[model samples]
Target: MANENCEILFDYLRSILYDSTPTQIDVHSLDEDFQKLGMGLQFLDHAINELKQCSTALAKGNLSEFNPSRDNFLCDNLKNIHANLEHLTWQAKQVAKGDYSQHVSYMGDFSNSFNQMTEQLKEREEHLKSEAELEKKHAETVNKYNQLLLELIRQSNDDVLITNIDQSTILYSSHNKVRVEQENEILYYFYKNINNPCEWNMKDKDNRYYHIVTINMEWQDKPSFAHFIHDITQEKKEWDRLHQQAHIDALTQVGNRYYFQDEMQQFLNCKTTATLCYCDLDHLKYVNDNYGHDKGDTYICDFVEILKSNIREDDIIARLGGDEFCILFINGSIDSINQKMEFINEEFSKQVVDYPQSFSYGTIYINGNEDTSLLNILQIADQRMYALKRKRKMTT
Candidate 1:
């Protein structure tokens, strides 16, 4: 019976060590020694079960239930594994928070990989920071240039306006000299023709003229317009003064020969009803030779004053040359033009005492014929005037 108990105790111990099957032990029927052996085997089985639970907790990353006894080899190994896992968890959290300096030392190949990852992360972070700084500097430079351009526009005399396509929103304006009525019209026109650039004239509230240039452009990613206005009122006045000097006779303050020809061509083009009267001073050369050139000048002025008094405000008289003159009597009949010429001759005779200030004149009435050129009309009048002058000389 002792042998049987001993064999059962030995089988139970072997099964605990090497097999997964449960062992049956008859401890109540055994002697003292066998009973003590059975109690030890039961304790070892319980310890093995506890060890399995600890191993399962570790596999699942749960360390709460893992308590290692002192000086125990297997438990000590588990404790070390748990400690390493906790430290690694802390390092991973630091790395997640942008601390790329976190490193591992004890995990051999894993430590090398972790350190390499941190180094690459730090390099990428630095590159991104550098890019951010460069972008900031570029933005500041663009802002500075914009400010300078704005200052230049403000200081310049040229009026500038920047607006959206509708012009309901004004983006920028250099000055506020544009009239409200004209401004509205300009915006309406620009909005309708946003693609075309143009130049034109406008008048402000003070009746001053402005030369305006408009261009199509983009502002803030939207279709827009730019208007540049230059005040040209003074320029226009100066141009008018120059034009008058060019077209007017200096001494007589009447139309010069150039003005006479220009008006003749315009009248012919429009088929106007008019009479061309060519006249020559009867004794201008005699007066110039006998009483000096200044007296001849006075004789000419006296003739012009008599001509102006008889003619209407619309009639144009011009000095053709030194001793010749021409008249364009607008809408005048042949009889009315003859009467005017006779009256002028009679009045000038009384004004000049030294030399007879009579003028011989020839008239050609325009009949609105398309074939009649300005040259032909002037030539006919000039020939008749010379014929009259020759007749007068023969009689004297």
Candidate 2:
């Protein structure tokens, strides 16, 4: 009978090992030795079943479903996996909440992938933070400059006007109350006088001069135009007075040395074809010594008139000093200028028959390609003029 019970116990233990439902054992009916073995088999089967249940829950990602007892030694390895998974779950939650310090060490390949993911996330977040800081600083700088521009616009004497071209209305005006009623007139003036962005001059009905500056701009999210106007009547008058004093000679009412230099520089910069002639009146000192100083003045004026009549309106004639003159013939050929110079000499001799007044002249053809300064050009022309005067003296 003990042998038969022993066979039953072995069969039942084998069934438990293979995870099959084992036949029940009656410990009371067996002998003492057999009963002790049957009881131990029952405990082994129970622990194995507990391990299976816990491990199954873990495989299904259900960590909270099972808690094995301390005596369940078969489930020790499973419990370790469970504890690590639970800690890893908490770490994942921390990572989601922007904490990047969490690490997993013992989960094999899964640990490596998870750590790499966290490191990339941390780097991305730090880069985004830096960009956000830079954007904030840029916004602050733009706003500060905008405020300064507004202050300058407010404090300026210029009449700041912003007009909505599409709406045909004034959007903003520095002199709002004063110029509000003149909206139609202002728009008319802008449409008629202003075609591009430029500084221009206009006169009001009262003959008051105003300097107008216009630019294309945007206002209130719409295409617009900004017109800055200031009364420049006094400014223009002052400038003209100063210009006349600086550039015009008092004696002959023509361009002085300063004006001649400026004009020569402009012509050279433009690189245009032109001709320069330097001339000096003959017997001017003799005329001043014999005839009165008034006659000598009359002689200079008559020569100026004759030169002015012979040249085109665009040509420049300037009295360099007493009895000396320089002329810029715009787009003049050497042949045409030489013929004109001969004619001028003949006319002067006929006009001043009493004192035999004539002139000596030297000419240079400028193709506008000379890499020379105004002073150098003037020196060359002066030497040529002296050479001609010496030749004339020898013949006389």
User: TM-score winner among the candidates?
Assistant: 1
Worst 10 residues of 1 by lDDT: 67-76
Q: How many residue pairs clash in each candidate?
A: 0, 0
lDDT of each: 0.80, 0.83
Q: lDDT value for candidate 2?
A: 0.83
**Each model's RMSD to truth, in Å?**
12.3, 10.1
Expressed as tens digits, the lDDT of each residue in 31-99 for candidate 2 is 877888889989998898888889899999999997898989899999899999999999999999999
Q: Relative to the unseen true structure, what is the C-alpha lDDT of residue 299 in candidate 1, on a scale of 0 to 100? A: 85
Model 1 lDDT, full chain set: 0.80
lDDT string for model 1 (206-297, tens) is 66777878888776568877888787889988987998888888888888888888888887888768888999888888999999999989
Model 1: how far residue 243 lies from native, Å: 1.7
- Where model 1 places Cα greater than 4 Å from the true spot, the runs are 1-150, 162-171, 176-197, 202-207, 219-225
Cα error of candidate 2 at position 12, Å: 38
